[model samples]
Target: MKSVLLALCIVSVSFPALAINRYNVQAMSCASVQQAVKRDGAAILRWQSARNPSLPLYDRYVRNGLYCDPNEYAKRAYVPSQNRANCLVYKCADISDNLLFDD
Candidate 1:
């Protein structure tokens, strides 16, 4: 019983807190955007159907986002405020469509 309790405590202490985050799409590329359907697994993004008439073709794309739980160490380890930024995606950068997460 004592051994088990020690094991549990050590295991918990070693790992960072994993959050069930609703993934946010930081951004997507124009080319990849063609075949893509979602910003993140849970959210969508602006796409070709709504292409802006005035703006020149994009050489790069950018976007933002949300949420997490962290211990003091993790909270400090990350520079961006928790739950305030979305993971970044790139277009025709040949990124895979089935990426599990942006990060």
Candidate 2:
């Protein structure tokens, strides 16, 4: 009974972490992406700006309904404008097949 309780406790502790899945968006520029992320709380895995390869992942201050214009800058670190309609939005669903939770 003690072992079973311990196992249950461990499972409960790790459940939240396991439920959360990181998401990545390919943006036209880091600034735009950052702005959008700041307003959306969406995790930015990488930013492929036109002027740079990629930016390091960082936590952003997201709000709600923040708009981003990818082509606003000539020199950008990412370029999601190339395929705005079909741009890839990376989420846990893309990486895993398990329907355990929604991030």
Highest TM-score scorer: 2
lDDT of 1 by residue, 30-92 (tens): 334422323432123332212553533222222221221121110111111123233233322
Report, for every candidate in turn, its global Cα lDDT versus the true structure: 0.31, 0.41
Lowest summed lDDT window (length 10), candidate 1: 72-81
Cα lDDT of model 2 by residue, 13-102, tens digit: 998545432434453444544455444444444434455556444322222222222322111122253235233332222223334453
Best by lDDT: 2
Cα-based RMSD of candidate 2? 14.9
Off by over 4 Å in 1: 14-16, 20-22, 27-103
lDDT score, candidate 2, position 102: 34
Output the TM-score of candidate 2: 0.33
